[model samples]
Target: MSRFTIPVCHVDDIDHESSKGFEIGDLNFFAVKRDGIITLFQNNCPHLGVNLEFQQDQFLDADNFYIMCSTHGALFQPEDGKCVYGPCQGQSLISVDFEVIEQQIHIAEAATAIA
Candidate 1:
C-alpha cells in the first residue's frame, strides 16, 4: 500500500506524549503512551463518530493515561485500543500507524487495514 507520511507535531509540545491529539490532512489523530509504548487512534469515537478532541484536552483522563471519549464518557486504553467503558464497550478505537522520527510524530502509513 502507498502510505502517506502525515506530520503531527513535535514531541516537546506534548505534555504526556501518550495521550494527545494530532491533526493531519484535515483529519485528527490521537496518541497515547503507556509503559513506554505508544499507540495511535483516530480522534473520532465509535459510538457517536464524533471527534473526542473537541474540548480542551478532554480526550485525556485525570491521570492522562487513557483516551476518553467526551461525548459518551467512554474510557479507552491506548495500549491495545480497547474501550473499557461506555456504549462501545466491546469495540476498539481505530488504530493509526505512526512513527516518531527526529522528535516529530509522522503518520507512517494510511489506514490501509480498514479497506
Candidate 2:
C-alpha cells in the first residue's frame, strides 16, 4: 500500500544514549540513540503486541544497552530490533522506515496502515 510521511522529531531532540516515544495519529513508534546513530522501531513488542517501555521514553535496559520490554523483560538489539533474550527470542521489534531532513526525523506511514 502507499505510504505518507509523518514528522516525528528532530535528530538532536532525542538526546544521546536514550530513547523517545511518539504517538502520531494512529501510529506508535520510538527512537533509540547511541553513539550518534538513531534507530527507529514500532513500540509494540512481538511477544504479545505490548509497548516495550515501562514508562514513557524509557525503552532501554538498565545499562543503556539493548532495548528492554517492560512486560516480559525481553532484550532487543538496537541496530536491528532483533530479540536476543527472553520469551520472544528469535522474534524482533518492527522497524519503522524513517528519514532525517534538515535534522528532523520523519517516518513514512500510510493513511490506513503503518507501512
Candidate 3:
C-alpha cells in the first residue's frame, strides 16, 4: 500500500459534532474528531464515487460519529468509513493517513495524487 501523510487541522481546531473536510490531491478527505481522536476518510461514496461534498459539508449525522452521504442516505463510521446503510453494503470509505500540526492540513504526495 502507498503510504501518505496529510496535515489536517490543528489539535485544538476540532471537536465532537464538528468536522473539517477538504480536497487533498485527487481525493476528498473528511477529517473528523470524536472522543478526542482524529480520523480521515476519502470523500467518495462507494455507491457511485460521487463526492460527499455534494451536500455542502453536511456529511455528519446529528450524532456526529459517522459520515452521512446525502446523495443516497448512506451512513459511514468516521473511524473506518464503513458504510452502515444505503446501496453500497459491506464496503467502506477509503481511509487516509494524516496528521495535525500547527492547525494546518498537509496532504502527502501519494494522497494528493488520488485527489
Candidate 4:
C-alpha cells in the first residue's frame, strides 16, 4: 500500500505537557507531550470508541498527568496509551505511528483498516 505523511503540527506548537488534535483523511488523532516526549494515538476512547477530548484539544486531566476520556473519565498513560483507570481498565488507546522531522510532527499514512 502507498503511504503518505500527515503533518500534524510543529513541535514547538504543542504545549510542553498537553495534547493537540489533528486529522488525516477521515481519521481523527491526537498528539501528546509529557516529560519532553511526544506520543500519538487515535482520538477514540477504548471503552466507548468515542472522542477522548471533552473540550477541543483537551485530553489531559487537570494535572496534565494522564489522558482523560471525556465521557467516562478513563485515564490513559501518555507513554504507552494504557488505561490506568476508569471503565477501560486494562484496555489501551490505539497508537498511531508518528515521527518528528525538522521539528514537525508527522503521522504515518492512515491505515486502510481500523483493526
Candidate 5:
C-alpha cells in the first residue's frame, strides 16, 4: 500500500499529441500528451487486460484524440482514461498518479500486478 515516485521522462520527451510507453517495477504504463497536458495510465486494456498498443508507442488512433487499445480497438479519452468505445465501453483505463517536477515526469510507484 506504500507508494514512491519514480522519474520516467522529461516533459519535453513526450511527443505532442501522442503517447509514450514506460515501465515502473513490473508494471507497464503509458503517458499521453495533449493540449499541453500530460496524462498517465496503466497500459492494459480493461476488456482483456492486455497491452493497449498494437505496435511500439502507438497508443493513439488516427486522429490522436483518444487512447486506443490496439488489440481490441477500445478507445479511451486521453484526459481521464474513460473508455468511450470498444468492448469495455463503460469501463476505464486505470489512471496512474504522476507529477511533473522541474520539467520531469515522475510516476508514482505501482503494485506489481499485471492486470
Candidate 6:
C-alpha cells in the first residue's frame, strides 16, 4: 500500500458559495467552499450512485444554498455533505478528507500502485 498527498487547487480557485469538480488520477471529486470553509466529497450521489452536478462546476442548487444532484434533484449540505432534501433524505455524501496548506487543498489517498 502506498500513500500519496495530491494537491487539488488553490482555495481561491473555488469561488465562495460554489463548487468545482476535479479528477485526481482515476478518482473523481468536487469541492465546495462556503463562508471560508472548504468541504470535499466524492462525486457519487448517495441515492443512485450518480454524479452530483448538473453541469461543469454547477453543483449547487438554484439558490446556491445546497449541493444538488443533477439527475434526481437531491440537495446536500456543503459543510458536512448531509442530504437535506430530495430522494436520499437523511443520507449523506461521501466526504473526502483533505488539508489546506498555505491556501491549497490537498487530499491524502492510499492506493496500490499498479505493477
Over 1-115, each residue of candidate 5 has an lDDT whose tens digit, in order, gives 3253678899999999998998767879898999999998888888998999988888999999989988878899999999989999989988888778778877655543543
TM-score for each model:
0.77, 0.91, 0.80, 0.90, 0.90, 0.89
Identify the runs in model 3 with alpha carbons over 4 angstroms from their true place. 1-6, 101-106
TM-score of 2: 0.91
Per-residue lDDT over 1-115 for candidate 6, one digit per residue giving the tens place of the 0 to 100 score? 2133777899999998889998876678899988988898888898999888989998999888899999989889999999989999999988887777787787775411110
Candidate 4: global Cα-lDDT?
A: 0.85
Model 1 CA lDDT for position 115: 21
* Model 2 per-residue lDDT tens digits across residues 1-115: 3242677788988989999998887778899999899999988999989888999899999999999999989999999999999999999988888778778887775621572
Model 1: colliding residue pairs: 18-32, 18-33
Q: Please write out the lDDT profile of model 1 over residues 9-110, one tens digit for every residue.
A: 776555554467666555567667666666777777889888886465457777776678877789887787788989999899888877787777777644
How far does residue 21 in candidate 3 sit from its true spot (Å)?
Answer: 1.0
Query: Can you write out model 4's per-residue Cα lDDT over 22-58, one digit (the tens) per residue?
Result: 7667778888999899998888998888999988999
Question: CA lDDT of 24 in candidate 4?
Answer: 68
**Cα-based lDDT for every prediction:** 0.71, 0.87, 0.73, 0.85, 0.85, 0.84
| Model 1 spans with C-alpha error above 4 angstroms | 1-4, 109-115
Against the true structure, candidate 4 reaches a TM-score of 0.90
lDDT over C-alpha atoms for residue 91 of model 6: 96
Q: Could you tell me the lDDT of residue 43 within candidate 2?
A: 89
Residue 67 shift from truth in candidate 3, angstroms: 1.0
Which residue pairs in candidate 4 have backbone atoms (N, alpha carbon, C) closer than 3 angstroms, thus clashing?
none
Q: Give the TM-score of candidate 5.
A: 0.90
Q: Relative to the unseen true structure, what is the C-alpha lDDT of residue 40 in candidate 1, on a scale of 0 to 100?
A: 75
Best model per lDDT: 2
CA displacement after TM-score superposition, residue 102 of candidate 5 (Å): 0.7
lDDT digits (tens) for residues 14-107 of candidate 3:
6566677777557677777778777777778899888775455567877776688877888887778888888987899888776545556555
